[model samples]
Target: MMAFANFLFIVFLLPSLEALSNVNPSEYQQELNTQALILQACSNVENLSSCLSNFQGELQKSGPPTAQSIIHAALRATLDEASRAIDTITKFNSLSISYREQVAIEDCKELLDFSVSELAWSLMEMNRIRAGIKNVHYEGNLKAWLSAALSNPDTCLEGFEGTDRHLENFISGSIKQVTQLIGNVLGLYTQLHSLPFKPTRHDHNATTTKSSSDKFPEWMTEGDQGLLKGSSLGMHVDAIVALDGSGHYRTITEAINEAPSYSTRRYIIYVKTGVYRENIDMKRKKSYIMLVGDGIGKTVVTGNRNFMQGWTTFRTATVAVSGKGFIARDMTFRNTAGPLNHQAVALRVDSDQSAFYRCSMEGYQDTLYAHSLRQFYRECEIHGTIDYIFGNGAAVFQECKIYTRVPLPLQKVTITAQGRKSPHQSTGFSIQNSYIFASQPTYLGRPWKQYSRTVFMNTYMSALVQPRGWLEWYGNFALGTLWYGEYRNRGPGALLSGRVKWPGYHIIKDARTAKFFTVAQFIDGMSWLPSTGIKFTVGLGN
Candidate 1:
C-alpha cells in the first residue's frame, strides 16, 4: 500500500518531510509515502484545486492513516459530493425555461438519482471491505457501479445538445465535480483492491444443480438450461400476455408491472404474438424476470420516442431493462421514428447478468443500448445506421447478425460508440463469431470516452465496413487512448492493409491473447450463463 512513495506530493506536506532528519528515517518516510498516495489520488481530478481543498487540513502531523482508512475516506467524500450533485440537479429541474429543457431536466434528475444510489452502494461496499470481507465480487460490483455513476453526468449533459445552455451551464460544474470525485475514487480503489480475478477453470461449488457437476451457478437450476432447447409451452408461466381476451393481461406492460419484485426464482411472462405499441421501463427493483415471446417479428414492441421528438437519448427506448438477471427471448424491439429521428433506441438494457437470444432490435440510430453491467446476446438481429450498438457495459455478442442500414445522405455512419471512462472498469463490447452486414460503407466505432474499448473476433464483415475499419471521435481526441482490436476477422472489410494507423488499434495476431476478449474472461459468463438455456461459446478453444 505504501507503493506510491514516488508519486506526487502535496505542497502542505513538504514541511513535515523536511523535518525528517529529527525523526526515525523509515517512519517519517512512510508517513510521507502515505501523503504522497493521497496527493496522487487527487492529482488527476478535473478540479484539482477544489479537490485538494476538500481535505481541509485533514493530514495531521501526529501519524499516518492506514490504507483502509484512506479508501473509506475517499468513498465517503465521493458519496457526499454525489448527494450534493443530486440536490443541484433537482434545483435546476425546477427552473428550466422551455418545455424541452424541462424534459431534459427530468432526464437529468433520473440520471442523478441513479448516480446517488451507486455512490451510496459504493460506500456500503467500502464499509464491507473495511470489515475484512473483500473479494472479487465486491471489487467488481464497486468498479461497475462507480463507472456507471461517472458516466451519468455526461449523458445528462448530452440531453441539452441543441437546446439552450442555461440549465446545462448551471449544473455542469456540480456534475463535473461528481465525475472527478468518481474518477479519483476509482484510482484509489484500483490501488487498494489486492485480489486477482478468479481463474477461468476454477470450479464453483454450485448447490442449485442436481448433476453434481460444476456447470451452472448456484442461482440457476439444471432445468433452466433445458428451457431454451425447445418449446416452453408446457413450462409453467407466472403470467400470460395476449392481445386477445384469452390471456390474463391485454398489454405487455401490464403483465410486466404485475411481476413480483426482487424475485429469487425466475418469474416467467409468456407473451403471445402481437404488436405491442408501448414504452416499457423495467426498473431495477424487479429482479430475475424472464420475458418469452412467440417469435421475432411476431412479438413486436414498438415506440416512436426519439431525440428529435424532445426526448433525451436516455429516455427514448421502446423497452428498457434495469433489473438483475433479466432474460428475454423470441422478441423484437422496434423504433419506428425513422432515420431522421437522430437518437431513437429500441432496446436499452441497464441490467446485470442479463441475456438475450433470438431477438431483434430495429432502429436508425442507437438501436441497442448495453448501458451497464454484464450482458450476453446470442443469435440476435441488430439493425441500425449510426452508432447503434453502444454503451459502457461488459457485453458479448455471440453468433449474432449486425446489419447496418442506409443512413441519411452525407451523414457518416459508425457501428459503436463505447463509453468506457476508466481503464480499470471491466466494461467493453465484444463481438465474437458474428456477422456485420452493411448496406453502406461505415466505420467500426469511434471512441465516446477516453478509455473506450471494443473488439471484433472471428466475425465476418461485409465490404460496406469500408477500408478504414475504425473511425476517430474527433481529431486528437480519444484516438490515442481508446483500445480497438480485431482478431481473425474474415471478409473484404477485415483487411488490415487499409486500416487507420492509430496507437490504440491492434491487429491481434496472438491466439492466447485473443482469449481475453472471449465470453468467459471478458464478462465472467462461465459461472452464470451455463443455466440460461441459451447456447454460448465459453472460450476460444482450439
Candidate 2:
C-alpha cells in the first residue's frame, strides 16, 4: 500500500516536488520532460509564460498525462472559452445598437450558437475516445470536430467586418483569446502526432495503385474513352452550341433544355469554340450530362455577378450544377468579377460522381466551389485569389495546376478552404500530384469551417507559397482540430520546416498514414475514375 501511494505521488504530484531539496531523480526528470513539451508547444503564443503556467496547473490535475489526456483537457478548456464567448456575444446582442449593427450581431449570434455546438462536438468526440472505442475514424473525427469548433468563433467575428461598433475592440480581444487557446490545442496535437518541426527518419516514397485491363467497367468502351481523351469535333453529338448558328442551339442552355429529361444515357453537349457569357444552371434532374468543349482557351463560360450586386455569396456562382454524374472536359469556367467584388464564384458543383477533365476554373475569389458529393478534377487548371477552391465536398484535384493570382496590397491569398463542418461528413480537398503556382504570397489553405480537411500529396509548390504554408482564417483557431497535411511534396515551397507550427498540419512520415488521403480513400475515386480513362495517380505521392 505504501509503495502504491509512493507511485501515485511520483506520477501525480511530481510537479510540486520541484521545491523539495531531495526529490527522486527519475521522478524529477519525468516531470521536466512533461513540462518542457508543454512549454515548447506554447512558445508560439504571445502570452507564452502565462499560457504555460495555466496549462501546468491543469496538467497537474490530469494525472500521468498521455497525449490523449492533454488533448481532452485542451478541448475542455476551449469549450470553457467558447461558452464565455457565447455569453459575451449574447449579452452584446441584447444591448441597443444600429440596425446594421443589429444585423451583424444577429449573424454573429447565429455563428456563435453554431460555434457552441461545434465545441460540444469536440467534447463528444473526446468522450468517445475516452470510452476506448479507438475506431479508425476516431482521430479523424476528433480533429474534424476541433477544427470546426475553432473556426466558429473566427467566423462569428468575420460577420462584423467593416462595421463601426464600440464593441469591436472587446469582441476582437475575446475572439483572439479563444483563437490563441485553440492554437495551443493544435500545437499540442502536432507535437504528439508528427514530432513538431522535426523531420522524421522515414523515407518519403510515392506509392501507386496497380493497373489492370479489367480495372474499368464493361460499359466504358475504348471508343468512348478515346473520344473523351482527344478532341470531339465532328463526332456524333446529341446537341451542339456553335454560337455561330451552325449547330443545333445558339446557347448551351437551349441545347440542355432540348435534351431528353431524366435520360439514363449520357446526354453529350458539344460546346463550340467561343466565349459564352452566360450563367449555366444544371438542375438535379439533368443527370449523366456531359459537356465537351473545344479546349480551355477556345471554349469559355464567363460571368461577373457578385455580392456587391446584391447577390448572395452562394447564388453568385456563374455555373452552378446540382446534377448527378455530370462531366465537363476541355472547358474554361470564368468569373470575370475582380477581387474587389468579393464572394464571386465561377463554378459551384453540388453534383455527385462528377468529373472535370482538362478544364479550367478562373476568378479572383471563390472560383470553384466543389459544393458537395463526390467530384474529380484531372489535369485541370484552377486560378483564383482567395479560397478560390472551397466547399464541403469530397473532391480530388489530381495532376491539376492551381494558380494563385496577385492580390491587392495588404491582402493575403489562400488556395483552398475546405468546409467539412462535421467529422462524419467524409468531405475534404485532396490535391495529388498537382502543381501550385502563385504570383503573390499564398497559403495552401485556411479553414473555411472548423473540421476543414485538406491534403497535398506529391504536388509541386512554388516559391509563392508563404513560409507559413497555411493560414488561420483571420485568426481562427483550428490548428489543433483541422486536418491539413503534406506528403512527399517537391519544389521550393515544399519545405515543411518553415510551415506554420499549428497542430492540425501534419508532415506525413509513412505511406500507410499518407494513403488515408489518397484518391481511393478520400472519394473512392478508384471505382469510377478509371471508367473515364482520364489518368489519376493514386496513393501517397511521396
Give all TM-scores, in the order shown.
Answer: 0.88, 0.63
The list of candidate 1 runs beyond 4 A from truth reads 1-23, 44-64, 195-226
The residue pairs in collision within model 1 are none
- Candidate 2 local Cα displacement, residue 155, angstroms: 13
| Candidate 2 TM-score over all chains jointly | 0.63
Q: How many backbone clashes does candidate 1 have?
A: 0
Q: Which stretches in model 2 have alpha-carbon errors above 4 Å?
A: 1-206, 209-223, 231-234
All-Cα superposition RMSD per candidate: 4.7, 11.6
The best candidate by TM-score is 1
lDDT of 2 by residue, 69-122 (tens): 676666666667667876786677756365545655655565455445655666
lDDT of 1 by residue, 1-542 (tens): 22332232345556667777688878887777676667765665655555555643333321246665666666666777777887777877668777678877887777777777777777787667656673545655777777777777788888888787888988888888777777777777777666322212533332112221334444444454445655553566789899986899999889888998878777888888999999999988788888989889999999999988878888899999987889999999999999988999999988878999899999998999888878999899999988999988889998899998889999778989999988877789999889999888888899988999999998999888889898878887888788999998999888889998999898998866678788666777755676565677777632
